[model samples]
Target: MFQQFSLTHVQFMLTGLGWTIGLAMIALIGGSIAGSAIALMRVSVNPVISRLAQFYIFVVQGTPLLVTLFIAYFGATYLGISVQPIVAIAVAFSFYAAAFLGDIWRGAIQSVPKGQREGAHALGLGRADTLIHIIVPQAVRIAIPPTVGFFVQLIKNTSLASVVGIVELTRTAQIVSNATFKPLEVYMTAAAFYFLVCFPLTLVSRGLEKRLKS
Candidate 1:
């Protein structure tokens, strides 16, 4: 018997949507912390540190995210280490997000005018002081649009957590579709939930870009 897609189903999916938000938050926070370090290392004066950071970014960017997730989730078990689904997801997403975010931030940092660094040097500002006080503030404006855009992409990418047995929004949609046998309705609702979450961020990104420009 086909079950009607009802309020109860919507509520169940809402619970899943909450988990989706939670996962995205985890990925973003972890990614940002690691990415900041990667960005700094990429711009390091030391050739060795910069090259190592470059290699890390290259490898992560070249590998597919799905493969990374599988390695994080299943590889742990193979190593006789037990881990929760969320833990593995967090690690994998952070690692994957760091590569791109690092590159995005590197470009932002480098985009600051060369004359600004020269001016800082003329004032006897140390490299660290110049970066912290002069360069970073300007780089932040350049970074915001692309960072927020990547965040929106990250939120949608959380759907991949389903492959690791995460009961996030997409997984809930799958369950609901199976039970009600209404994939179109169930999936359409899931897409709406994603749009509702992501669309606001898009508007915020644009607003910030305009405000920063002005």
Candidate 2:
């Protein structure tokens, strides 16, 4: 029997929305760690190291996000290790986000003018010092917009956690819709919630891009 969409249903969805945000934050922080390492290795002068990084990024980025999730969940089960939904989702999204973020940041770092490096070399700064004080700062400015834009996608991708039994936004909406028999209302509400979370990021990213350009 279909029940009415009640206030409680809305509240439940709100709780799930919180989970979605939390998952995205996890992905961001963890991915940033993994991504920095990947970016550094990708740009390493060592051909072997660079090739390895390239392979890692290619394999991970080429895989479907859902397949990553499945590996985090079911793959762990096959290995006889239990995995919680949040942990699995975090691990999956972290590696997934790392590939793209690393690629984005690598491009940003390389996009810096070669003259900047020449000037740093002329100043007697070591490679590490040049990167820390000069190259990184400039690359960071270039990277901010794309990084934030990727965050928007990360937030949306949290919906995939539903398949793993995480009560994130999409899963919560599905539950509510099933009970109330109101898929349209529940899904629209979910879409509104996602827009509320993501639209501000788009604005901020665009603003930063213009500021950087100027």
Candidate 3:
């Protein structure tokens, strides 16, 4: 039975792994942009803008990803919209990623000392100028560690995309286990693959955190 683990299965799973990585990259990049916007919005002095951003973060963070997936896929159909699973999963994960990242970045931005902002003001730097040249750069240094850590979570969350039939790594593992009748071996392999993708990131994030602290 062990000998029956064919190269074709390996090939298929490898392809699925690629898709998983691709989707994760998409989510990370798109989420980073959207999340930055939301983060800035959250910190804006405009009460309406801040509240809207807060509400968006609340709704996305409050709901489970599975429900988000269902809504992106099936709910859209109910609303007379056609959606592909990959597209639906990407959209859902992007929004989910944005919410968490927004919060993370907001914290980082806020962590800038009040005195620093006051100093910037004294230097004749207006709010926008201060944020761009002073606050954001410092915040970025503080943000790097957690941002990398969040990437690991983002990669893992891509597994949930499988429920929408996106044929990513988790879905491939399911297919392989169904075929090989070796849940243990297949899942173990999948776990190793996930670890391979994430462990280095974890180390890098930790290292950055330590260096920043120093």
Candidate 4:
């Protein structure tokens, strides 16, 4: 039975792991674009724009990823639109990631000196121009560590997508374990694979944090 842990299962699991990474990368890219827009809106002087951004962040952060997944799956159906599990998961996580990323970036933007903004104003830079030319570059430095750290969280969160029938790493482990009746070995391997993907990102984020401090 122990020998049932064959190379075939290993290859299958590796393929699933690749899907997990691919999904995560998609979420990161999509989330970053959406989240950046939300972050900027959050800091907008216009009350309505700021409120809208705040509301979006509030709803997303307040909901669990699982609940969000259900909404994405069934919600689309109710609206007469068919959605795939992968698309649903990607959409759910993009909004989910956006809320947190927006908040993190907002904090980073706020950390910049108020005097810097005034100085930019003195140089005749408009709000958009000032943010682009002055504030964003500085905020990027502060945001990198947390943003990278969040990638690990995002990767782990991909496991949640398995519930929706997405054939990512966790789902692959479940299928293999059910077949081989070796939950311990199969799941342990899955754990190792997750750690392999995430641990280096952890170290890299820490390194960036240390460098930022210096």
Candidate 5:
């Protein structure tokens, strides 16, 4: 028997929406921490450290995120290690996000004018001091636009968590659609939820870009 899409179904999806937001937050925080290390390593004076960071980025970027998620979730069982779904999703998304964030940050750091570094050197500031005080402040301005853009993308990508049994928004929509036999109504609601989350971030990104430019 087909049931009508009702308020109860919307409430169920709201629960999923919360999980989606939670997952994206986990990915963002984890990714930012790891990505900071990777960015610093990429800019290291040591050739080996820089090359290693480059290699890590290369490998992660080359692999599809779905594959990475599968490896983090399902592959653990094959190796006799138990992994929770949320834990696996966090780890996979973090690792995937780190590669791209690292590169974005690296470009931002490098985009700092050469003359600024020279000026810092003239003032006898060491590399570390110059980076912390002079370079990083400027780099942050450059990084913000892209970083927020990626975060919006990350929020949408959390839908993929459904593959690993995550009851995030998309998964909830699936369940509701199955129960109600109203795929169109269920999925459209899910899309609206996504847009509501993402559109504000898009506006903020644009606002930041304009502010930085001014």
Candidate 6:
């Protein structure tokens, strides 16, 4: 039995889209902070600190985002700890984003010309000032395209948060589909919304890349 899709259904889906954006923002902010630390630590003079950051990146990047969310949401039962599903989803996605962002940025930072770094030190700037003043500004431009790309990925991955009961876009579509028995229409509509959100970012990423090239 199928019911016709209505304007209300469209509005319902729109609300879900809001949640998707919110989740993506959470992932972006949390991931950036953690990623910055990891990237800096990876370049540390101390071998031990560098190795530990490397290990963190390896394990995180190696694991699937869904599995990480599962552990964050469900693994807590093993220790009798309980957390809200949204909290778990946010934490998982953030850490997942962090690993990839860290790698992206580490490459960007290392890509800065060696002479530039030496020049900073030669001017009597300490390592920290050299990096903050000279290194990161250059690295950030290199980082933008990839960072935007990862944010797009993060937006799509928020669908997984629905599995943990976070009522985001995909979850909303599932509900709408069930109510109207029009899974195809509802899902296609959901896909359209996703494209709507992501296509602009893709264009922006391209524009930024071109700008950087010039």
lDDT top scorer: 5
Angstrom error at residue 134, model 6: 0.8
Per-candidate clashes come to 0, 0, 0, 0, 0, 0
Q: Candidates' lDDT values, in order?
A: 0.94, 0.94, 0.90, 0.92, 0.95, 0.92
- Which residue pairs collide, candidate 4? none
Task: Give the TM-score of each candidate.
Answer: 0.97, 0.98, 0.95, 0.96, 0.97, 0.96
Instruction: For residues 109-182, write the lDDT of model 2, one tens digit per residue.
Output: 99999999999999999999988899999999999999999999999999999998999999999999999999
Question: Candidate 5 clash total?
Answer: 0
The local lDDT score (0 to 100) that residue 24 gets in candidate 4 is: 88
lDDT of 4 by residue, 97-167 (tens): 88989989998999999999999999999999999999999999999999999989999999988998999
The CA lDDT at 156 in model 4 is 94
Order candidates by TM-score, high to low: 2, 5, 1, 4, 6, 3
Q: Provide the global lDDT of candidate 2 against the true structure.
A: 0.94
lDDT tens per residue, model 3, 1-214: 5435577887788888899889988888888999999999999999999999999999999999889888888877898888777787788888888999999999999999999999999999999999999999999999999999999998898898888789999999899988888888788888888999999999999999999999
Decoy 4 TM-score against native: 0.96
Worst 10 residues of 2 by lDDT: 80-89
Worst 10 residues of 5 by lDDT: 76-85
Q: Write the per-residue lDDT of candidate 6 for residues 1-214, one digit (tens) a residue.
A: 7668888999999999999999999999999999999999899999998999899999998888888998999877677978777887888888888888998999999999999999999999999999999999999999999899889999998999988889999999998999999898899999999999999999998888899879
Q: Write down the worst ten-residue block by lDDT for model 4.
A: 1-10
RMSD of 3: 1.6
Segments in model 6 whose C-alpha atoms lie over 4 Å from true places: none
